[model samples]
Target: MKKGFKYVFMTLLVVALMLGSFLLGNKMAITTGDKVILNKSDFNIYSKTNQMKAVIDKYFLFDVDERKLEDGVYKGLFKGLNDPYSEYLTKEEFDSFKQSTSGEYKGIGIFITVTEDNLIQVVSPIKDSPAFKAGIKPDDIIYSVNGKVYPGDKLNEATAIMKGKDGDEVKLVIKRKNSTGAYDSIDMDLKVEKIKLLTVESKVIDDLGYLHISQFGEHTYKEFTENYEELKSQNVKGIIIDLRNNPGGLKDSCVKIADYLLPEGPIVKTVDKNKKEEVDMSDAKEENIPMVVLINGGSASASEILSGAIKDYKKATIVGENSYGKGIVQTIAPAKSFGIDDNGAIKLTVQEYFTPKDNKIHEIGVKPDIEVKLPDDIINFGPDFIDTDTQLQKAIEILK
Candidate 1:
């Protein structure tokens, strides 16, 4: 009877162990049953994605490239965020972008953008580049490339057509407004060249330091500080920061430059979705020199950050039209970092940054203390082209 009791006890223990394992598996939704139960919220969250995969696998006619399909799905997912600044970069595009950040590339070396009027406008031609040599001016509307007419919104497509192996020639048909107020077509034959991007251009104009930052890049702060130090050594009375047609770049670079220029204080603040605030502060010990910043509609992102900080701190007089007003901060990460095998990356808008004075300039851009509009005749003239820069004149006047 004792042996029988022992056998019954051992059998009950085995049954209990099995019950525990089953319960644990069920809790984790890991049971290999035909239909594993899931929490209602979790089911709702994943059901649409599962359904989309099922529909695509079943109804798609072509033998789809699984990789391309996956990329499309990811791109679509980000597009659903309804944020223009958020985007998924394909492997090739991401690699190209990485190359650009290094401040070197094989291209025509002109920054182009789609305007609000559905025109492909040249933001600016890199100084001493093939485009600049070929006389591709800012605000020039690109009508066609090599006889191919691309829609204005297809800025990337147009850019690709313009970029080719070094020494290759691309023909651009551009329309510029003539003195009579009518657009005149001009043909430009430009040869692609290896472009080494330079972000900072400096000169001393009548004892005032004139610094033109084309765009903030990875090496911008180093270039800026070197020029700034040289200007200070020259005993400059004041400074002018020209940020016209600057599409902006790395925020760290901008903040560092601001720190070097401004007195010790907060530079900018960023707030995430959870309302967690992160402030970037300046540690400069010297008093800020009298200065003026030049801005225009093309000034954006990092440009806004630097100019806004200066404006908020009363460090400089801001001159020109309203800026582009891109206040959202983007964080880029590789797909592998997020547990995906795709050799691509996502640039997601993770936070919104505010000026030092807690001013948020997202859709509404930072206003200038002194507003100066570019004249129609001189709009195409480069930012530092100097001859017809009324905005620069205004800045110089302010500094003086």
Candidate 2:
């Protein structure tokens, strides 16, 4: 009876040891396996990311660039929002964007955007720029750069390809519509140089002042004031403010310029997502010059803002085709605040702007007082191709 009792005790002790070992093995597996199995109650937002990282670390066959992986994740996060105006900028891209806003850079000096058809279209070439000298025109489609086809998705990527150090040469193959409306490919050789943004161009024509504002950049107001003063000194009868193909810039600059042109009233108003309104008003001092503002399909953002205000105030007669309707205000912020490092940033659409009369021109652009379409043949010509520029002629006649 004593031997039988000892046998049972030994058997029970062995069973307990085996059970303890099994539990320990499972604990180690839960902590060290390629994925962690979490209880439903303990699962959190970050749990899936951790699980994915573990799985990739253990099972991905090829080496991965961790930095690129992180960038992809950041880019994917914004892309998932499905907003085209909102984007993730890399460190390099952010630096380039800053340079652009400062009104200086090394590039071909052209503004571009992706079209609804996914074609890369040149909004306009900066006045007296390498691209302008090369006869690059508005609505020109960029097919390839340096023999490599550029996907028309990121404007910054296309700008980067066109930019290089001084004396560097870049080749572009552009596809433009011919007189028959069929696309024709034209190869261009352009040399990169230090591009100083020239935002304002003015001339006196037949006792009238012609002022073309290519963009509303940092120096635009100062330039606009100087130009206006010079035109006023010339005792011009009227002035034409050309904003055609002007992909807009600084709102403050546009507002200040509008202040010089508008009477004592509200210039523009903006509303945030929280339904808060902020209004910008103009002082009593006004230019009061019989004026006309030119616009086209490429006039956007601040350009639209300026035109809308002028239209509301009857400050100028707007001419040309319908403007590009981009009434959203974009605010830039550092990516680090969103858990991204390496000096990256994002430009997000934060507010919607309206005209002083409370007209919203977001997707629907401001209609011109006189709608005139450029001749198809003249549309593809260089910036100086004014002989066939009927829109400018119409403005000249209006001012005359």
Task: Choose the strongest candidate by TM-score.
Answer: 2
Model 2 Cα lDDT, one tens digit per residue, 1-400? 1243335445544543453321333342122244443323223323454457668778999987776666665676666565666777888888887788788899998888766666788877887788888888777999988888886565556678689789888999999988788999999999999998878988888798888888988899999999989999999999989898788988999999989888999999999999999999999999877999999987888999999999999989999999988899988777887675457898788899999999999989899999988886463422355678888888888888
RMSD of each: 10.1, 11.9
TM-score of 1: 0.78
- At residue 139, give the lDDT of candidate 1: 66
Tens-place lDDT digits, model 1, residues 35-97 = 544433443335565566668778988776766666666777776676655778888768877
Report the Cα lDDT for residue 2, model 1: 29
Q: For each predicted model, how many residue pairs clash, with residues at least 3 apart or on different chains?
A: 0, 0
RMSD of 2: 11.9
Which residue pairs come into collision in candidate 2? none
Highest lDDT model number: 2
Instruction: Assess every candidate by TM-score.
Output: 0.78, 0.81
lDDT against true structure, model 2: 0.81
Off by over 4 Å in 1: 1-66, 112-125, 130-159, 171-189, 379-384
